[model samples]
Target: METFLKLFENPSVLKFTKLGLWILLIVLIIGFLRKLLKKRIEDTSVRYKAQKGVEIIGYFLIILMIFMAITLDDIKDYTIIIGLFTAGITFTLQELILSIAGSFYIFFVRVYKPGDRIEINNIKGDVIDIDSIYTTLMEMGEWVSSDNYSGRIVKISNAFVFKGPIKNYSMDFPFVWDELNILVTYDSDITLAKDLILAEANELLSEYSQKSKTKWQEMVERYYIENATIEPTIAVNLTDNWIALNLRYITDYKLRRDTRNKLFSNIEKTIRSTKGKVTLASTTLQLLKIPELEVQLKNKL
Candidate 1:
């Protein structure tokens, strides 16, 4: 009993006990706040931000406790030394530090959020998660057409946002402009082919175009942007062996493949129904005249 009482009376023992209690209290408070915020906030993004804020506060509190315990009475004398040491360590881990900074930038600036389809450094994918140092993506567009997923998950360092362009496909504008070209033999009816393609594109993408216009108007109001045509358009160009009918339209970023498939199916049906009037073009090799040098080579032999 005496020994135990003496142990409690020791200044170091009492300081450590106090520090532990403070840490426990801080943790409990942070946990309680986190639970309360989660219950109150229904939005996933807002909830994520609240949780992150609570975590940062908890970290600061823990660090303060450690600092207080270490400094005790000589805080002024140790401050400069600790600051210099921290600076040196930060310099050594600059990339990691930058990644963390990028994460904060992404969160505050809304560069890209979860469920946003984005491309960074030529890697296109749908963002699945974002942490302090990395952004997780369900990868798309490698060995897959029309931005479809490649069935791979990629973890990219958040620092890449500072290194290269970040293309957010579904940010403020959830639509992207895409075009498809149909080739027909020059002998086919050029005007008829153009008309058919335009009709098909308008039929398939009309609703998408209308929705895109509404969203685009919202974007224009929010940001500095020029008004663009949101309706399907057609362009015709004559190639050496074929006439190219290009159909351009807007579509939801995530539904590019499905949209393309529907457009192609409709166009195919229209062309097939047209019979010979819209015959697809194909390359052919013809013998202009058998090589005249054949007989001369045989005589030399």
Candidate 2:
């Protein structure tokens, strides 16, 4: 008991003890406020922002307490030394610092938001969450077709925004131009096939064109972009074995797969209803002639 009392009597020990108590009290108060804020905030995004701010402030306070404890006198004399130390630490953690900066950029500049589909450095996905150091993605189109999710969640460094291109599918213009190619045999009625495809695409995608036109107009007004035709179009290409009719149309980014499926089903039904008028093309190999063996019999008579 005497030794414990003597230790407290020392000025250095007493100062440290007071500093420790203050740190503990600050941490408890900050934690309590964070919990209260989380409960009061209804929106998850707002809650997340509030909690992050509290965490950053808490860290700063703890760091300040440590500095105060270490250097109680002549803080001005140590300014240069602290600045050099900070520079070294910043250099070591440059990537981390950049990621934090990226998070702020994402928040303020609106590079992307949760639920927006984006592709960065060939990694495409829907944004799941934007964190301080990482951006979470529900991955798409690795082994799957037509922007469908591949059942994988990927976390990429937020600093990737500074590294490569960022392609957003559903930003200002939420519609994408997709194509479906139908090949018909040479003997089939090419004109009739083209008419049927164009008719089907127009009927199925008429509503999409209307919706895209409004969104596209908004995009034009917001950015320096030209107005484009959002209607369905048909282009014909003559291949070696068949005539390919390409049906191009605008569709919502999320509904690409479903729209394609419906369009294909309708086109199939329409073509099949034509009986033998529109014959689907298939690859065929024809053997013109087997190599003729010229056997000149040498008669040694």
Query: Which segments of model 2 are wrong by more than 4 Å?
Result: 1-76, 287-301
RMSD of model 2 against the true structure:
4.9
Worst 10 residues of 1 by lDDT: 292-301
lDDT scores for all predictions?
A: 0.86, 0.86
* Model 2 error, position 254 (Å): 1.2
lDDT of 1 by residue, 187-220 (tens): 8888888888888788878888888888999998
Report model 1's TM-score to 2 decimal places. 0.77
Query: Clash pairs of candidate 2?
Result: none
